[model samples]
Target: MAQAMLLSLRRISRSFGGIQALDNVSLDIAKGDVIGLVGDNGAGKSTLIKVLAGAHDPTSGDVILEGRPQKLSPPAEAQRLGIETVYQDLSLIGTFTAAENFFLGREIAIGRGPALLRWIRRKSMGDTAMRGLEELNIDIPGIRSKPVDRMSGGQRQLVAIARGAFWGHKLLLLDEPTAALGVRESREVLDLIKRLGAQGLTIVMVTHNLDHLWQVCNRVVVMRRGRKAADLASSATNMEDVVAYITGAKEPMTPRPATTEAGA
Candidate 1:
């Protein structure tokens, strides 16, 4: 028998001012799944991420987490529901140390009373941060306290991922994580993403890199004109199909489950 889905979006719709960003889109993401969402510039890929991450409320539709309906009014609400988003051009504090940035706005502290509260537990955060970085194979030279100002760009992005992976990341949404990275750096980031997914974190990556998608994702979700064009099993699909979808050479085809529903 098939297992219950972990997340589902129902009749989702969104718009910005007068522009229709998403048009009654819907999908499901199950546990231990990695979905690669691909589309053109204005195909609503980023907009969908923001909606799922709680950065933007959908004009309509509800996000179901753990099979329970949820209203994602803000990013904090999404995080509370174990949803994390790692976005391109929106990672790390260039001025803070890696350890500092790791616990930014979310420090791990030790205290008993309100008046007798203790100082910041640097050692605790540092230790955990070190373990996370090691797991990701992110080389930060010396200690985990090394400042981001001294670290490489790739390191910065890796740290951001490690931060999310260290906490509530049951459903991770990665938007162009390697968009501006060097070849080697991009691989490092992609490897970390895979490592996280291997740990049973359901991940959705919005990337333009077909090779990376083929390498990491179990399924692919292609969008066109703000609607889902295809949701194909990676092994059952081909480059020709994806290219055809991207260029509109092929008409959009819904997933097989949707077809079965109509027949039923």
Candidate 2:
């Protein structure tokens, strides 16, 4: 049976001055989907992600989330709606511990007669962070106290993802999650992503690494020149076919063995 639809992009389009970054692209993301967004530079992958993250508004189109239309702008609105984005930069404070970074903006406070007089709950935050990581089966030693800068690249990425997973209840968007990690670290990060999916966290990932995408994503969405070129089931298509779509060597057609009720 097909999964229930989580989000629908209705003829989404975006333009930068005269340049069209996205042209009437429509997509449906189902619950528990791990969609891999792939394309070359200038393919509008980043712009599309920003649109979903509420960082950029479509020039014309609608975003429907769980059957209700939304105007996702200025980012905070998206966060409130349970959509979290982890960008390529990771956005962790190098000097702060993992627990601190996990609750950077949304910290727990106690005895708050006034906002300024309230005290932050350090131990509670650390214990909660540790529990969340353990639930994801992520074994990062000293994650509660170690500074993100002191950890390895892969561990840092995992920490950022864990933070997103903790807060984002509906959707998690990741941009080039394993971009600069070593082989071992990349493997660890991929394993964590798989674990998140197994726990029913819907995810959309943007990455240049096709191998990594195949490992974690159940579906692939290919973009070319600011438009969706192809959307296919990862198990039904090969890397060569996906590359062909990305390079414009193959035209967009109805995907075989459609993975979603909306049909690719």
Candidate 3:
């Protein structure tokens, strides 16, 4: 038998007064599947992700998680429901050490009452943070004590990912993870995303780079002008099709002039 769907956006809609950010958008995500959302600048890709990440509530419609209907009113609600999002900006405290950032806002308490304020459990937090990185197959040059400001862009991305994965989240939303990374760093980040998917976490990445989408996603959903244009299996379709969908060219032709950008 087939497995049950992990997340579903049922007729989801969001608007900004005169502008409809998303219009009756519906999507179903399965467990362990990597789906890429593609669109133009105003195509509502970010808005859709924000809704899924609990950054915005739908103007109308429901976001159902794990077969149960829910109203995701706040980002905290989604986080509590095992949904984690690592945005491009990735809100990390650069001044904090790796371990400090890892355990930020979630310090290990020593007791259940007022006596619990024993201070930050330094040793335990560092060890646990290191192990989490190891589990994600990340190699840290320094110990967890290294400040995030000292780490590379790729390392910072890894830290964001490690934070989400450590809690065994059910769904992870990635917004342009590889946008500014160099060749090797981009590859590393993509590999990590795949590893997370292999470990059974659903991933929904929003990117215009069809090459990255082709490399990391199993399915691709195209969004155009605040609406879904098409949803196709990556293997069954090529870059030409995606470009065609994005540009509204709908040209009856081959070799989309913008096809070469796929390997990046």
Candidate 1 clashing pairs, residues 3+ apart or interchain:
none
Note the Cα lDDT for every prediction shown: 0.81, 0.90, 0.81
Please, what are the lDDT tens digits per residue for candidate 2 over residues 1-264? 456789988888999999999988888898999999999999999999999999999999899898889898879999999999998884799989999999998888887577788789999999999998888888888877788889988889999999999999899999999998989999999999999998899999999999999999999999999888898889999999999999989997653323334353
The 10 consecutive residues of candidate 1 with the worst lDDT sum are 255-264
For candidate 2, the lDDT comes to 0.90
- After superposition, candidate 2 runs with Cα above 4 Å error: 111-115, 254-264
TM-score of each: 0.91, 0.94, 0.90
Per-prediction count of colliding residue pairs? 0, 0, 1
Identify the candidate with maximal lDDT. Answer: 2
What does candidate 3's lDDT look like per residue over 93-144, in tens digits? 9888877777776766565556445666788988998888898889977646
Error of 1 at 260 (Å): 9.8
